[model samples]
Target: MKEKSNRLLSLSAIGLVILFLIAARFLTTAESVRQSFWALVPPIVAITLALITKEVYSSLFLGIVTGGLLYSGYSFEGTLNHVFVDGVISVLSDRWNVGILCFLVTLGAMVQLMNRAGGSAAFGKWAGKHIRTRAGAQIATILLGCLIFIDDYFNCLTVGSVMRSVTDQHRISRAKLAYLIDATAAPVCIIAPISSWAAAVSGFVEGENGMSLFLQTIPFNFYAVFTIAMMLFLVAFRLDYGPMALHERNAVEKEDLFTTEERAGDESLERPLRQKPGEVIDMLVPILSLVLCCVVGMIYTGDFFSGESFIDAFAASNASTGLVLGSFVSLVITLAFYMLRNVLSFNQCMDCLPEGFRQMVPAILILTFAWSLKAMTDSLGAKEYVAAAVKSSATGVLSLLPFLIFLIAVGLAFATGTSWGTFGILIPIVVAVFQGTNHVMLIMSMSACMAGAVCGDHCSPISDTTIMSSAGAECVHLNHVYTQLPYVLTAAAVSALAYLLSGVLAVSGITDNPFVSLFGGLAVLGLVLLGIRGGAGTKAE
Candidate 1:
């Protein structure tokens, strides 16, 4: 009875919000509508509905429809055409999107091949002998995620595939696995000097050596540094709180990793140990091959063969195309290896092609919807609105610039579900502010932008990193978002406070030592975690 009432209430609320949005269309001019707050409404509605109902597909579709309706000014024909044609179709038509989709399918097939050949099961057995504790399993996942910092998408999928069996053997919740994958993905990449993320950030700076500037910002990137610290602390001290705690408790006591009825498309996450035996090399060989090939592919795309240095090639690489090229080669190699080893027949190896596509369908659908929704936001001038707002108020409160930029970046990235978009919109404005005047503050502010963009991407359900994390762990997407939110917020709060202190020091002409701010932030984070740990014990007592 309670469930039914809650459902009714949620539906009622959704209906009211939709009606309000439609009525708002009539109240505002079309020209001003896209540039106004209405540009952010659709994603807000979609995120809200997904959280409220725990149904991502319908919630996302409704959000896309809302964006279409707003874009069309409530016109029936325009709304239908815009939602499918300009939104979904347009996103799917892009070459980058196609490449990413192809990469996903190929990776999925490779994972399937490993499973069918009993490689994953063999690796699980080997891991169980070594990784005897839940903490050990999780730490291993984190380490692997960090090592694969070439790209966040690669990190998520690769880590999830590699670590799932180990974590499951130790009774770690899939949601927790997803959180670990996500925490390591973007945060690690953002700080890694040679990563695709560094390349992207470097491209945004003007009038300075972009790579050198990016290198300087790393120390002041409090969120990225502290997130890794928080993860280590949580694992070391066994401090689980909020929804994650509940999930962890169930996994330990009930041996129920899911803890909810809403498993969705996560059936693919569960592995059945194969009777046909295989070696641990089955898993490691393919994964290593994929990594090496991906690195080569990225440089190749950047014209490395034409004499560019490795770092320069990497900085100029196209991630989507490179990943597709690499994954496809790896997939073909895996098929041949499995057949040659006689662990699987040629026919059996061929069977994984379609099976792999089927497993990835859920991820593909979500990506398509997410991309389409972003299109809707873009069409409505979300970027322009955010850019204008940042530029307008940036003239005042020079000391608060980092703090203000952090907050605004968080909001924009969270709303639009694109950290890169946030970087493109805000970084130049930041560069323009302190470019020649103050290098120290410029670096500080630049770090704030990167940190805030990551924090927002870390938490936003619509983020590709978040989506791929869920897909990789085979956890329900919303479960991953909800369970991870409290932890992300905790880290973000500490990061925000750190930025405030750093900004003040930079403005007052004091010593601009990043270690001072970084250590101070770490101290604050340590205290907060200790408090939470103590409180959890008291509650138990």
Candidate 2:
């Protein structure tokens, strides 16, 4: 009965959307629709459908079709060509996209190898002895995520791989684990000086010392800092609310990490093999090697060996290519190490190759669909429409620009599901808006852009980082999305308020200290959490 109801709802929503699109086609010219508010309709439709139906693949594909139709003026042949040849094929063939796929496959294989070697089981035993509580397990995951601040993709997979055993031992919900992995991924990378996110942000600011500007904006990064603080607070106080609270309760009380019937991955992959138990060093060595090699690979791409400094090379490096090279080397190293330990024969290791690829298939499929959706948005000039909107509204709201920019950024990033693209679009506009006028306001606005972009990426279901987090934790994709959305929105609300306060202060010329707003935001977040905790307690009683 419930399934039938859901199906009917989904169909009704689709019917309404189709009717609206038909009316829109007759109402506006294709070129005008492509360049206006209609450009955002497809993603909004996709997001709404995903949330309502709890299905990602069909939702994304429908969005692609919507985009194709809009871009090609509702011609059936044009829509087919645009969505397939121009959208999916175009993104799949991109060099960087291929590199990311290689990296995912390699990382998946590496994870399978570690599991088969009994390294993961040993680590679980080791952690159970030392970190006995659920809070401890959660905190450890956060700290590990913080340490791998090089790339969001690397952070998601690596942290998830290493910590899943410990988290499972404590009955931590995979949704919770995924949230921790994601919160630490892009947020940590954006704030870190030597990360791929910083490099992307720096590349956007053409005239300024982008690195210096990024560092200066760190204190004003309310979302990232507050998110870290919120995670710790929630853990320390044993607080959980919204869908996450339900997931956690099921996990703690019933030992059901996933309340839903869907198993996102093959549970057998995470199970200990029938071989003798391996040492913890078996897992540690390969992960550490991957990290070191990946860092080197990034720098090498940046011409570090050719005499460029470490930081400079990192800033110029191609993260996708570098990750592929690094993970591939780390795979070879893991294979040799496993052989040396006599954990498995060559045939077993070879068997894991296909097994690992199969494990990553879900993530790969979601990513490809996501990339194609973004392609459709791009073809319709979503960025241009957003940029034009921001520019047109810039004149009278000087004091409120930071807040406005933050809101705009969040909406854009959420719709498009790419923080880097959000930064690319908004950072340049912010720079142009306040390049010579107000340096203080410029810094605040830029910081808001980063914060908003991260916040949106943190929440969006179609986001690659978000998808990777689910893959890493082996959680159902919708479970991760639903569980994390409330937490993300809470943090974003506080960050938005902070941006408003900061913008007002800067415009008033009373104070330009970034910490004024930073500390203020943290205080507000603490109070909000306390209130939530109190409310939850009262309801329980």
* True-structure RMSD for candidate 1: 1.8
Worst 10 residues of 2 by lDDT: 532-541
Task: Encode model 2's per-residue lDDT on 40-78: one tens digit a residue.
Answer: 888888898899889999999999998999988889899
Number of the top-ranking candidate, with TM-score as the measure:
2
TM accuracy, model 2: 0.98
Judged by whole-model lDDT over C-alpha atoms, candidate 1 comes out at 0.87
Q: Could you tell me which residue pairs clash in candidate 1?
A: none
For candidate 1, lDDT tens digit of each residue in 1-541? 9889879977986888778886887787656777878889888988888888777788888889999888887889999999999999999999989999999999988988888887888899999999988878988998998899999999999999899889988999999999999999999999998788888998898888888899999999999999999999898778888899888888888888889877744355335335657789999889999999888888888889999998888888898999999898888888888778777788777777888888889889988998899899888988888888888888868888898889988887887788888899889988988889888888998999999999998999888889999989989889999999999999999999999998888789796899988999999998998899988621110
lDDT of each: 0.87, 0.90
Per-model tally of clashing residue pairs: 0, 0
Instruction: List the candidates' TM-scores in order.
Output: 0.97, 0.98
lDDT of 2 at 505: 87
